[model samples]
Target: MITRFEELDWQDTPIGELTLRRRTEPAVGQEIYEVRLGDEYLMSSLFTVAEEELSTLGLAAATGDDLSVLVGGLGLGYTAVTALHDDRVTSLTVVDRLGAVIGWHQRLLLPVSAELVEDPRTSLVEDDFFALVRAAPAEGEGDYSAILLDVDHSPRHQLDPTHADLYTVDGLRSLDRHLATGGVFALWSDDPPDEDFLETMRAVFDGVVAHVIDFANAVTGGTSSNTVYVARSRTAGEPASDRPSKAGS
Candidate 1:
């Protein structure tokens, strides 16, 4: 049996209907928070291993002091909060296209929401992550120390159709322009590693690593897995187009 603590917040978005609900699991006596996009579940507090790792591994490969990070999605506040846990992260900008998702955190509708808002280093940005990343960088300026992106399901399958291009060589070049020297860019994928996507990352960044994350699913009573792709930027003069193309390689 389950008990709902508050009325569900539902909103119609350009993409679909977004809903936030709070509940208590009587079986375990645990408070649970969930976010759903239409009929599909976006995130749940119960499954956070991969979301947390998106930050852990993103910063682990980053080489810098007082690192500034940009998290692409604010789902359940797991990735943003995890990044703040690291002492090296001086600041984090959590960006999402959906204002409702950001508002849920602002209104404390979710359990992890408070932790993200209370942290001085954390700033909630309500904007499309792709648009922000693709914008041209200011002259003689670097944007972020690390970028942890979980906006889509995977490189091949995107929550939005426009995201598919971002996984390609031309699209990755746009993101590479904003990274600081040796900065890391990590992506979380629901499916296993894709060779084409890995090649695209390799062509754009210097160091590329694909991590397959495995965790047990209590609801399904079976093992589940996700993939994390991490890559580091190169110094000046190494433009993405200059490198060998993933298609040719």
Candidate 2:
């Protein structure tokens, strides 16, 4: 009988808990857990296809100079780092609710993500993404050229329940308000969303499109993949009725 090499027990590192376990021959990648929550898979570097897709969409939407962008969920900072690489982006705002995650990024993940956060155009906001989008400037404020969201595992599989509200009717409406004319909204999902979710996006925006990126293991270089959704705004030549109407006297 043949045996595969077994490594040390999973260690809960500061960045995120990492487990070294063996699975069937078909499943052969490191499993990562969220240390603070325990038993939740945050994500592994093994699958970064979605992250790259997000960067691609964000840059495309930012067609002009001095483009401003808002990215929700810092994660491993893959998407943010990619966004910062573009010179057209004048400002990059990153919002994440977990301080621990931020700490981990600063401590352990800095070597990989520091440039993205330390760049002159980067600003880190420790707050709830929902509140920030909902409470945006009332009117005449400059809207973001792109809003990239990766809060949940995907639209169908959310890591946190509170995030479900983000896809709701009111939630979509609020998201549309934050985009500049001709801005784009991009979402990263572990899997494809349901038909209704797609419909909701269409209702909120004039046009919507979905794109999927396949991934491969960097270690073994095998074929494995993930999906990402990119929804562009229909803001061209359209007046800003998306914002709330002022109260009548």
Candidate 3:
């Protein structure tokens, strides 16, 4: 018997075919977890520096000492696990549109899944992140201290094209309304900084910064990078309700 790898789960979704696979990496001599959407690789346990950074840096940006965080993607649980690493994070809600992905974690098919689900502070919500963020109540205790997004590829590209609107000025403003005062919003993008996306964020939020995280790509044996966009909520503004929806959102 070849003790190399196995296919654990596969499913069909609205956008495309989804797969969960685990394999032994001969080079690294350890098991690796992977998730794929159609023909594209979505995430791998081998490389998660950027994902962890998104949570760490994002939570650090939140002004609140005790944080309530919302993570837009579940992936291999790297991002959410990272968020919990910070003791300041009192609560974390992870939202995903796919139920199969959640099942994997709940079943403990992945290594990190056990920690995430077992934690009392973690809650998993199955929903469309884009619609949820946009439709959230404009203000109230429903707001989160920080929102870390790892759902799509980037603002310019996406796993689901519909995610495009969430990066728009209007969509961002709507999301802002769901943030607690002095909240922080961070996104993990596999691409570099986008000037247009930066401009849109600046108009809707108080401050914005794009961080480039570099990592070695084992497959290509070359350096590769990802970007994390972190922005803050406007603190000293007139009530957000009075603000006009930016044109061309």
Candidate 4:
């Protein structure tokens, strides 16, 4: 039998004080894993439906086999692991700003950590996903077929104020340079669909859709929903060759 709760690991990161913990859920009578940054709850194993759907809905929009995927956030590993479930995905690069989060998976501290770390298609890269999207990849590296982002709370609320720019039209254009032609860009947001952000995405992408994923809420005993914004990289009358070919290593 496990104790009611246990702190698995703790680290002082440049962002904040990060902590991983495991606890027994009395309602479900099962162990739950959670990660917290400072006073905010970053992820909970109990509520991963939306996270998994972020990968599912994103990849569904992508076209082509042997897809290369770049995941902007590595939380409980559900998003990355779910992306690998698709046989079409040949390579997956998961980037997180904090190295401590990557260490949790490398150490197999979380239940799904081993699955992500052991998968040959997966590469755990420690870097700022936001920064990488705006920069060029290494010489041999290529653009990704899909970029799934789950970092900020929403287009309006960010974990860090510096992330505000990524929600803007200019910032999105910089990110657009990192995707292959017809590639997909998907984002997970805690809030409902924002019309303003939707307009912002449309300025760069050919088509954009916001998918609301509803799931059972164990804590609330009701249904909760999260929005996944899926955008295709090709714009109207834009030649495929005109788009920039760049990605982060």
Higher-TM-score candidate of 3 and 4: 4
TM-score of each: 0.90, 0.76, 0.91, 0.92
Candidate 1 structure quality by residue, lDDT tens digits, 1-249: 657565469999989999888777564468777888999988878779999998998899987688989899998899899999999999888889999889988988777789899999988988988976678877854568999999898888899998777888888889988888788899998988888788878878876778878888766778898888888887777655444423210
Off by over 4 Å in 1: 2-7, 25-29, 139-142, 238-249
Give every collision pair in model 1: none
Clashes of each: 0, 2, 0, 1
Q: Across residues 1-249, which tens digit of lDDT does each residue of candidate 2 receive?
A: 233444323455533554433222334434422222356656555456678678777577556887898899887678888888888888898898766556655654433456765688988777888777777556765388889988787776766666677787788778878888778788877765456677777667654656656666655667554555566676566743454222110
User: What is the lDDT of every predicted structure here?
Assistant: 0.84, 0.67, 0.86, 0.87
Per-residue CA lDDT of model 4 for 118-213, tens digit only, reads 999999999988888667666767478999999999999998888899999898888888888888999999999888898788778866878888
Q: Sorted by lDDT, highest first, which candidate order results? A: 4, 3, 1, 2
For candidate 4, the per-residue lDDT at 234 reads 82
TM-score: the better of candidates 2 and 3:
3
Q: Please give the range of 10 consecutive residues that has the lowest summed lDDT in model 3.
A: 240-249
lDDT of 3 by residue, 49-157 (tens): 9999999889888875688999998989999999999998999999999999999999999989999999999999988988888786744545799999998889988
Question: Lowest summed lDDT over 10 consecutive residues: which window, candidate 1?
Answer: 240-249
**lDDT for model 3, on a 0 to 1 scale?**
0.86
